[model samples]
Target chain A: MTTISIIGSGNMATAIGTRAAKHGHAIELMSRNTAKASALADQIGHGATVAALGATPAGDIVIVAVPYTSAVDVVTHYGDALAGKILVDISNPFNADASGLATTPDSSAAQEIAAAAPEGTPVVKALNSVFGHVLAHDTPLDVFVAGDDAAAKAQVAAFLESIDLRPLDTGGLGMASVLEWTGILLMGLARNGAGFDIALGAEVR
Target chain B: MTTISIIGSGNMATAIGTRAAKHGHAIELMSRNTAKASALADQIGHGATVAALGATPAGDIVIVAVPYTSAVDVVTHYGDALAGKILVDISNPFNADASGLATTPDSSAAQEIAAAAPEGTPVVKALNSVFGHVLAHDTPLDVFVAGDDAAAKAQVAAFLESIDLRPLDTGGLGMASVLEWTGILLMGLARNGAGFDIALGAEVR
Candidate 1:
């Protein structure tokens, strides 16, 4: 029953918005390109609305669904408007060629977003590992969430569970690098002949 | 039919040696401590021999199966003897706490090993993703190989195939960063209730 704002109109943004709407969460699809956002919003129907970029919609959670290189730019654009709100980062810092990873030695994409956003704004990293097609189909995908704020992670986890997905809490934001790299490795496996339908799940026996 | 020398008596070294011996390759186990290497060599049996740490055993390939912090020291111990040889680096520059990745932004553990080795020596990065127990159990694990030299990569891939493991060539040495980070990610998964029984495999549909 939470309101969610997605700050992009790409495949990932659409996927998250669609799933969020299906989970009974109100969604605002925001994009720099209004046409693209409106088109997606029109396609997604109920509980979904289209809006222009920099529009501060009423939402409990704001998802930055842009690319890793553009993540900082998107966060900067939002500014203090995102203060005290929950920010979910699902972008992987994959290189331009998609051949490998593109991250700093000690920092991660989520860390960069947390640093860019206003203080006290909870940043949760999740949904980067699941493919867009899989999310669209509502397949059983394991979503790994990592953040300093436990309650914020639990909120995202509850929303994820509502959409028929499982949430694996992978400790604090420092562990976001591991989660981001997992997506990159899975991408490499998929590109080099591994089926994208294959999802990495953990089983403890 | 390449002679390969492994420079550790750890689980990784033993797993590689066992697989190599199964394929009728000449395998030499060397360690700074001779007794442990001798014990491992005895356990592996079948044409595998224990050699002194400084001894440059005649081998077409030398795999450095040590920790990231110890890789440079081990390579330096072998000195100019590693010239023109194919040195395989299977180490990831992850912190001891396994919470953070510790490699240069542009470089990786494989690159560091290549730089530490003598000039003209080819270094291939592989086996960082597969677990030691999976290696010992001869499970179907995918090993991603990357290096600057195609010939060296081909040689390493051939060796990997002979060991009954699938080798996926993930392009040049720059891609080694992703491969190394895969291990770090897997470690996180393993620590967080994910068992080591899971192996990452890639296949074309």
Candidate 2:
């Protein structure tokens, strides 16, 4: 198992941290508020750690589970501490009201985070298509991942498989825009009475 | 069986027309070039007819199966001929390079056609996710339908089901933008080496 450090002690952090911890991966829940981070870590309880904001990430894989707007600030604040680590961005750049995509099609939240992170940091985009609550359920959905770094993508895919989830690779980092759109579409469908039961799956032959 | 009239003598027109013809739906293949349209109808001899460009559409469902650029013109050119008939748009508004979506998030090809057609015209969006070649095969993929008019959406969905394809209803006309984005995502995945054997399907729980 891998050591996974999750930034932002929110619902997404708790959900992902719980899954990773249950899969035998050591987890670190980092937050600006030490109490919130410690609380999430305690809830996760498989020897998960609590880290303060701006500290060096405790895991080999640093998951930035924050809002799209604050993604750049978090990456920049970590600075060189994130250098050479596998940074996973699980944020969707969705505008208010879910009316349309917030980011241009040419780029995505992962790409923006990649630009902000220190050099040599491999940023992969995953866990954004399906709802965080869905993965927390007993049955999880297929996960779509995209990143330019081959090794980084393989590592993330392996982690997904370890938790009994399907990882659908959609090629290089450029595919992140489409991946984020899947989230917007899934959310739009969910709100429009398609229900919250949403997951990306393969076509039946 | 519902009658389906498909405009354009292009790949999509032939592909969709052939499928509809096989499913016992009376079909009309229309084009600006009479010979090309006639040839397609002749190629598909299941009681499919050919209509000239300005001629009145033959079926209750007139599929504007042309490129995204020609959609508005096709709806407006028919004018009163399309009145009271269900107009189904299967166009994907993609940029030249197909790197991103060319349409705004608020509107889609179907909405634009709905606006251009004479009063009482119902425009439903369908069959834009997978390639036409996929449907030309024995097994077809899932078809997503979206429209403001419930009756129009039902007709399109029924036609798709008759062809043994799954039709997913993605809610109101506003979902059309997201529907169009699905095409962009599929194309981006196809070009990025995921291959043309693409079909939109839900995960097998």
Candidate 3:
């Protein structure tokens, strides 16, 4: 079982942590709200622990589950503490009203987080395209991932597989921008006709 | 059966024309190259006829099956001839190497074509997310459509349904930009690992 550290106590963080924990993986909850973090850890059970916001994460894979605006800041604050760790960025840079992305193709949230992260820290973008509640459900969903490092993507894919989620790698970190757009597409679909429970999948025909 | 007028004798035109004809829809092929358009019409069969490039399209729904760069020009040239007709924009504003979109979200190919069309012309963006060959296949695939006019979008959705394709309306014309990025995402998925035979679908779970 792998140790998965989530840096936020929000909906996404809780969903991913709970699922990972249910899959026999240890979850290290790191949040500025100590009480909330501790409560989340207790709720997850199975040896789940709470870590300080800026402390070195115990998990090999660190998921920055914060908002898009704070993702880079969180990584920068972690500094060298995140060195050699696989940083997973699941932030969607949606503009106001969710019509378009706040970040451009040149500087997606994952790209910005990678820039702020310490050297040797491999940052992967996953779980950004699916809704938090859908992910919370115990169903196999397609998770599109993008990262420059091959081994880092493989690790994230393996973790997703362990949680009964299918991972579809969409190429290097540059494609992370496309994944962000995909999040917007999902929102558009949900708001229009496809509804919120729908997930995007690749059908071989 | 709808009379589908396709303005281009390219890969997309052939794919869409052949499929529409097989579904009992009459196809009117219009292209700068007379020989190529006639050849495509003959290949499509079922009374598929060739029309002059600038002539009023014989079909109620005129699909501008040309490159992104030439879509607006073609619409502008059609001018009042396209008035009161449903225009479908299936061009992907893909930048060189397909790494990024050539058009920004503010001015997608659909929006540009809409702006250049006659006052009553309703330009709907569809068939941009999937590959041409996939559309040529017999299997039903999800077709995402975007348009500002509800009636026009309904017509396009009905056309897609008649041809055994599911239509998912994203939203207004603004969502067309998201659909453009989705094209890039599909290319990324194909080039990375998913292969070219895959189609993006909305899985309700």
Candidate 4:
């Protein structure tokens, strides 16, 4: 079983952590607040563990479940602790009001994290397009992933499959912007009456 | 059946013109080169007609099938001719390399066309996500639409339905940026090995 470490104690982190644990993959919830992390670990109802933020992650795959700015901060702070590990960035990089993207056209939270990480660290953008409520429930949501390393992408895809989620590889790390913009498009659709439970999937014909 | 006028004699124009004509919509192909427009109209067959660039668009739903910059030029050049018409802006607004958006974050090509068009011209953003080749052939494709006016959106959706394409309303015209970004994301996916035949659909559980 693969060990997945989530670097936040929020809804996204909990959602991914719970699903991973349920799938028999080890779960580690790491947050700046040890108490909150432990509480979440207990609430997850699995053999989920906790670690203080900035500590070395035990799992081969580490998911940064914080907001765009905070995700960048956590990844940058972890530094070498994340080296040689697959960093799954689930940040949408939305603007403050969630109306649009905070990142530029060429950049995304995943790209920022990838740029901030050490040379050997592989950054993968995933789960940013799927809504959290859908993840909390049982549903087939397509997750599009973009990263520079082929081996890292394969590992991330394997983990997603383990958790009952299908992943679509959308090419190089530059496509992170596309993945992030899709979140904005999904939000716009929701606001236009599609609701927040919707999932945006990239499919082949 | 709704009469659809497509501006520009490029691939996008031909694709929309052919589909609209085959679906029994009155097709008018408008271009700077009247001969080219006539050739496209003839190829489109199904009684598709041709018009000069600045001539009054015969159809109520006028689709600006040109690129982002040229779309704005066409809308502005038409001036009062487009007033009271349903203008469908299908520009992707991609930068030179197609890696990013050429427009500013706050604005989009559709919004730009909406602003440039005379008052009372209801602008609808449609068909920006679906590729041209996909539109050329008979295939199911999801067309996300955004417009401030409900009546205009309804007409565009009806036109899309007539052509056997699904129409997804994604809120106000401001969401045009999201629609355009989805195109960039799709291109990024194609670059990432997903190829150009893929389709992105927004769904809910």
Candidate number with greatest lDDT = 3
Please give the C-alpha DockQ score of model 4: 0.67
Candidate 3's TM-score reads 0.98
Q: Which stretches of candidate 1 lie over 4 Å from their true place?
A: A1-3, A19-26, A51-59, A76-84, A94-104, A129-138, A161-168, A182-205, B1-3, B22-26, B195-205
Worst 10 residues of 1 chain B by lDDT: B196-205
User: In model 4, which regions exceed 4 Å deviation?
Assistant: A104-106
**Judged by DockQ relative to the true structure, which candidate is superior, 1 or 4?**
4
Q: Please give the CA lDDT of all the candidate structures.
A: 0.81, 0.82, 0.91, 0.86
**Model 2: lDDT to the true structure:** 0.82
* Tens-digit lDDT string for candidate 2 (B1-205): 7778888998899888888888898988878878989989999888788877867877888889889898888778888988878988889998887766677656677788888999878888888887888878859576777788998888888888888887777777887877787887777556544677767665423
Write the residue-wise lDDT of candidate 4 on A1-205 in tens digits: 9889999998898888888888898888889878989998998866889987888999999999987878777788988888778999999888886778888765778888888888778888889988887897856678889888899999999999988888888787888888887887888888877788888876765
Pick the winner on DockQ between candidates 1 and 2: 2
CAPRI tier for the interface of model 4: medium
DockQ by candidate, in order: 0.25, 0.45, 0.82, 0.67
Name every residue pair that clashes in candidate 3: none
- What is the full ranking by DockQ, best candidate first? 3, 4, 2, 1
**lDDT per residue as tens, model 1, B148-203:** 89898888888898888878766678778878877766676666555666555443
- Candidate 2 lDDT, A1-205, residue by residue in tens: 7899899988788889898899899998878878989888889999999877888987888999988988899889999989879999999888897656688756888999999999878989889887877778747566778899999888888988888887777777887877887887777657654667766665534
Question: What is the interface RMSD, in angstroms, for predicted model 3?
Answer: 1.0
* Model 4, residue pairs in steric clash: A171-B192
